[model samples]
Target: MIPLVDLQTQYKSIQPAIDAAALRVLASGEYLGGPDVSAFEQGFAEYCNVGHAIAVNSGSSALHLSLLGAKVGPGDEVITSPFGFVATTAAICATGARPVFVDIDPLTFNLDPAGLADAITPKTKAIMPVHLYGLMADMDPIMSIARQANIAVIEDACQAHGALYKGKRAGSIGLSGSFSFNPGKNLSAVGRGGMVVTNDDEQAQFLRRLRDWGQDGRYNHVHQGFGYCMDTMQAAILNVKLRHLEHWTELRRAHARRLTCQLKNSAVTTPPEPHCCRHVYQVYAVRSASRDLLRAAIATRGVDSGVHYPRPVHLQQAYAGLGYMEGDFPEAERAAAEMLSLPISPELTDSQIDYIAAAVWSDAWRPRAATANLGVKSTRDLARPAQEQSEQAA
Candidate 1:
C-alpha cells in the first residue's frame, strides 16, 4: 500500500550522514546540551531569521516555555484557532491561562483575524495562532490587532518549517514561535525535539532558563522551572537534516502541484495555496461530501489516506467544561467531517502520486446524491436494497 509518510525512503537517502552524526555524538560522551545542541540552536535561529533559538525536549514544551517566558500566567487569556491539534490549546492551559477559541478561515484553515478583536478583553494576554498544515496564518492583520491590544503573539509553527507569508518566514513574524522535530516532520530528528525562536533578547534568555531547570548558571537556580532540555543526539540528527530541508520542501511543493492539476475537475476539493503566501503542503488535504466513504474506497484501492483531525479542539470531550457545544464553530465542525489527507511526502515518486490521484478521482465522482448523507447511513446500507431486489427476482 502507498503509505501516508515514507520515512524509510528519507532515511535511506541520508543514511551515511545520519550514521556519521550518530557515531560522532556517541563518541563525544556528552549526551545532553553539548556543542551539537548549541550549534543546532544557532543554525536554526539563523534559518528562522531570528535573534535566538532555544532548543527543547518537545514542541509542547517549547510552547509552555514561550508562554512562561512571555509572562503569561493564571487569570490571563490566550486566543487561538479551534481547528487545530489539541496541543495548541493544551499548552495554553498548561500556562494556567484560559484558551479562548475562534473559528478559522475556510480557505486557509488558519485562524480568522476578523474574530480577534471580539475575543479580546482586559484579561487577554496573548494570541497563539497555529500555522496548520504548513500554511502561515494571516499574520498582517493578526499583528495589527495584537499591536493595538498590546498583546503578545506566539506562533505555533510546528508544521511549518520553511513556510513564508509575504516574504517573511513563519516563525519570524510573531513575538516568539514554536517548532517540532518529530520523525515525520519536514525537518525531522530521529527522536523527539523542539525549539523556540524569537528576536526579543529578554524572552530568549528567559526561555533558556526555563528549559534548563531555571538555571542562570551550572549550579545556580534563579527561578522555578522545568526539565525541558533537548537531547544532543536528536540535535545532531536534526542539524544534518536541516541542510537538505529546502530541497525536500521544494519536492513536496512539486508533488502538491501535480496532484492538484490531476484532480482539479474531480468532486474532491483540492486545498488552496494563495498568491501572497507560500504553503509547504506538509499535508495534501482535500474536502468532500463523503469524506469517510472516499477514504475507505481509496484505502481499498491500495492507497493510504488519513484525517488530520476528525474533531475540532473545542468539540473534544476533554474541553467540555470550556462551555463549547456543538455548532459553536460551524466552519471548524464542518471541516472536521470533510477533510482527508493524501500522501504528499517528498519521498513519493511521480507514478505514485498519479496512482493516488486516480484513486481519489474514482471514488470522488460517485453520484453526489448517493454519497451526500452517508454519515447518517453507510454505503452498504444504500446498496442493500438493490441486492434484495435481485434476490426477490431469483
Candidate 2:
C-alpha cells in the first residue's frame, strides 16, 4: 500500500551514514549541548540564511521560546490563522498570551492578510503566520501590517523547511522563525527536534538562555527557563539529513507538479503554487467535497490518504473556552471538511505517482454507491505513460 510517508524507505536509503553519526555521538559521551548540536545549529542557520539558530527540544518549544524572546506575555494577544496544528496556539498560550484567530485564504490556506489588520488591537503583541503544508505564507502584506502596528512577526515555519516566498527563505522573513524536525517533516531527525532562527542578536541570546533552565552559565540561573535542549544524537542525525534536504525538496516538487497536472481534470481541486513562491510539497493536499468517501475509494485501490487537520484549532475541544463557534471562521471550517493529504514522499516513483493520480481521478468522479463495486482498473489500464501524461498536462 502507498503510505502517506514512508520513513522506513527513507531510513534504509541512508542507514550507514545515520548509524555512523549516531554512533559517533554515542562514543563521544556528549548527548546534549555538544559539538553536534552546535554544528547543526550553525548548519541550519546558514541553510535558512539567518544569523542564529537555537536548537530546541521540539517545535512547540521553538515557538514558545521565540514568543518569550519577543516579550509576549499575559494579557497579550497573538494574531494567527485558526487553520493549523494546535501547537501554534499552544505555544502562544504557553507564553501567557491569548491566540487571536483570523480566517485563512481558501486557495493558499494561509492567514488572509486582509483580516490581519482588523485583528490587531492594543493587546496584540505579535503576529505568528504559519507556513502550512510546506507553502510559505504571503509575507509582504503581513510584514507591512506588522510594521505599521509596530509589533513583532514570528513565523511558525515548522512545516516549511525550504519553502520560499518572493525568494526569501521561510524562516528568514520575520523577526524569528520556528522549525520542527519531527520524523515526518522534510528535514526530519530520527526523533523529535526543533530550531529557532533569527537575525536579532538579543533575541537569539535570550532564547539560548531560556531553553536551558534560564541559565547564563552552568549552575548560574539567569531567568526561569524550561528544559528545551535538543539531544546531541538527534542533532547529529539531523545534520546528516540536512545535507540531503534540497534534493528531496526538488523531488517532492516534481512529484507535486505531475500530480497536479494529472488531477487537473478531476473533481478535486489541486493545491496551487503561486508564482511568488516555491512550494516544497511537504504534504500534497487536495480539496474534495466528498472527502471521506473519496478517501475510502482510493484505499480500495492500494492508495492511502490523510487529512492534515480534520478539525480547526478554534473548534477543538481543548480550545472550547476560546468562545468560538462553528461559523466563526468559514474558510477554515470549509477546508477542515474538504482537505485530503496524499502521499508525496521523495522516495515515490513516477509510476507510483501515476497510479495514485489515476486512483484519485477515477474514484473522485464515481458515485458513492459505485465505490462498493469499485471495478478497480489495473495501473496499466488507468495510468498513462509518464511522457504522455506530462505532455497532456502541459
Candidate 3:
C-alpha cells in the first residue's frame, strides 16, 4: 500500500542529526524556549524572509497569538475563507472575535479576493486567509481591500511551507502569518509545532510575551496569558528538517507534476498550477462527478486519500450562530461535494501513481452528465450511468 505521507523515510534520512539534536537538548536541561528554540527562530525567520518569528506549541496557538498580538478581541469580526481547517476559524473565535466566512476562487481553492468586500462589515477588523492546500491566495486584491478598509491581514500559511505568490514568500506578504509543523505537513517536525512570522517589531515583541504568560522576565507575571510556548524538543527536530526543506519541496513538486501529467486525461479534473504562484501541491486535489465512488475505489486499490474539507466551516455544526444556511456560498458548497485529494505526498512512487491513474480509468468510477447548475468544472463530460447520476442528484 502506498502511504499518504512517508514520514518514516524522512525520519530515517535525518535520524542521526535529529537524534543528536534531541540528545543535546536533553543534556541541556532547559526544555522550554532555550537556545535551540532561539536558533530555530532565527533560522525559520531567515527561511521565511521575515524579521521575526515567534514559535508556539501548535498552529492554532500561533493563530491565537497572532490575533491577540494584533489586538483582536470581542465584538470584532475577522473575514477568512470557509474552505479550510476549523483551526483557522476556531483561532479567531477563541480571541472573542466573530468569523466572517468568505467564498473561495474556484481555481486556487484559496479565498476569493473579489468576494472580500461583500463579506465585510464595519465590525470587520481583519482578513485571515489560509493559503489552503499550500497555494498562495491572490494577495494583490486581498491586500488592496485590506488597505482600503484599513483591516489587518493575517495569513494562515500552515499548509504552505514555501509557496510563493509573485515571487514573494507566502508568510511574509501579509502583516503576519501562522505556520504548522505537524508530521503531515511538508516541513514537519516529529510531533507538533508552529511559528508566527511578522515584520512588525512591536507585535513580534508582544507575541513572545503572549506565548510566555505575558511576562517580560522570569517569575514576573505582567499580564494574564496562556501557556502556549514552543519548546526546544520540537524546534530541535524542525531545525534538522529545515536544512532539507527546499530539496524535499522540489521533490514534492516533481511528484505532483508527474501525477498531474498522468491524471490530465483521467476522469478527475486535475488542478493546474497558476503561473503567478508556485503551488507546492501539499495536496493534489481533483474534482470529479463520482467523488465518492472514485475515492472508495482508490482506497480499495491500496492507496490512501482524504478530503481537505468534507464540509465548509460556515455550515458546520459549531457555526450555526453565524446565521448561515446552504447555498450562501455556492462555489465553496460545490467544491465541498466534489473535491478529492489523491495520494500526492512526498513519498509516492511512479508505479503507485500509474496504478492510481489506471484505477481511475476503470469502471468503478464514472463521470456525471450535463447539469445546468453544475459548478465543479470538468464533471459534466464524463460517462456515468444515467441512473447513478439521478440517485446522486436526488
Candidate 4:
C-alpha cells in the first residue's frame, strides 16, 4: 500500500548523513540547547530569510510563544481563518485571546485578505494566517492591512516549509511565523519540533525567555513563561532533513501536478494557483460531492487517503461561546464536507498516484458546484469537540 507520507523511504535515501548527525548529537554532552540546535536555528532562519529562529517543542508551542512574544493576551482578539488545522486557532486561544475567524478564498484555501480587513477591530491584536496545504497566503494585502491596523501578523507555516510569495519566503513575509517538523510534515524531524522566526530582536528575546520558563538563564525565573523548548535529537534530525527540503518539496509538487493532470476531467475540483504564489502541495486535496464514497473506493485498491480537516474550528464545541451559527463562514463549512486528501508525498511514485487517480475515475465521482454555498453546521455545535466527534462518530 502507498502511504500518505513515506518517511521510511526518506530516511533510507539519506541514512548515511542522518545517522552521522544523530550519532554526533548522542555523543555530545549537551542534549537540548547545544550546537546542533543552534546550527539548525541559524540554518532555518537563513532559509526563511529572517533574523532569528527559536526552536520549540511543537508547532502549537511555536504559535503560543510567538503570540505571547507579540503581546497578544487576555482580552485581545486574534483574527484567523476557520479553514485550517485546528492548531492555528487553538494556539491563539491558549494565550487567552479570543479567535475571530474569517472564511477562506475557495481557490487558494487560505485566509481571504478581504475578510481579514473586515474582521479587524479595536479588540483585534494580531492576524494568524495559515499557509494551508503548502501555499502561502496573499501576504501583500494581509501585511498592508495589518500595518495600517497596527496588528501583528503571525504566519502558521506548518505545512509550508519552502513556499514563496513574490520572491519572499512564506514564513518570512509576516511579522513573525511558526513552523512544524512533525514526522507527518513536509519538513519532518525525528520527532515533534517547531520553530518561530522573526526579524525583531525584542520579540526574539521574549520568545527565548518564554520557551525556557521565563528564565534569562537556565534556572532563574524572571517572568511567567512556558517550558516549550525543542530537544537536541529532533534538531539533529531536522538539520539532516533541511539540506534536502527543497528537493523534497519539488518532488511533492511534481506528484501533485501529475495527479492534477490525471484527474483534470472535472470529476473532482482540483485546486488552482493564485497569480504569484506556488503551492508546495504538502497535501493534494480535491473537492468531491461524494468524497467519502470515492475515498472508500480508493481504499479498496489499498491506497491511503485522508482528510486534512473534516471540520472547521469555529464549529468546534469549545469555542461555541463565540456565537457563530451554521452559515457564519460559508467557505469553511463547505470545505469541511467536500475536501479529501490523497497521497502527494515526495516519496510517492508516479505509478502510485496514477493508480489512485484511476481508482477515483472508476468510482464515478463528480464535482459539485452546489458546494459553493453549502453551509454545514459546526462539527462542535452539539457541545462536543472535534476529537470527541471523531471518536463518537467512528
Find the candidate with the highest lDDT and give its number. Answer: 2
On residues 127-240, what C-alpha lDDT tens digit does candidate 2 reach at each position?
A: 999999999888999999999999999999999999998799998989999999998899998789999999999999999999999999899998999999999999999999
Per-residue lDDT of 1-394 in model 3, one digit per residue for the tens? Answer: 7777778877888889989999998999988887888998999999999999999999999999988877899999999998988999999999999999888877567888777898889999899989988888888888999999999999999999999988988799888999999878988877789999999999998888888898889878776788988888999888888999888888778777667666665667776566567778788788875688888887787877888788999899999998999998877887788888877766667787788777777766555531222354421123446664344223
Ranking of predictions according to lDDT: 2, 1, 4, 3
In candidate 1, position 355 carries an lDDT of: 97
Worst 10 residues of 1 by lDDT: 373-382
> lDDT score, residue 320, model 2?
95
Candidate with better lDDT, 1 vs 3 = 1
TM-score of 3: 0.92
Q: How many backbone clashes does candidate 3 have?
A: 0
lDDT of 4: 0.83
TM-score of each: 0.93, 0.93, 0.92, 0.91
Write down the RMSD of candidate 3 (Cα, Å): 6.8
* Model 4, span 27-66: residue lDDT tens: 8867888888899999999999999999999998998988
- lDDT digits (tens) for residues 1-394 of candidate 1: 9999899999999999999999999999999998999999999998998999999999999989888887899999999999988998999999899999988877677888878899999999999999999998988889999999999999999999999988999789988999999877888887789999999998898889878889999879998989999999999999999999999999998888788878876777777766567788888898886788788889889999889889999999998888999998877887798889999899999999999989987844463533232233111111325554344223
The whole-model lDDT of each prediction reads 0.87, 0.89, 0.83, 0.83
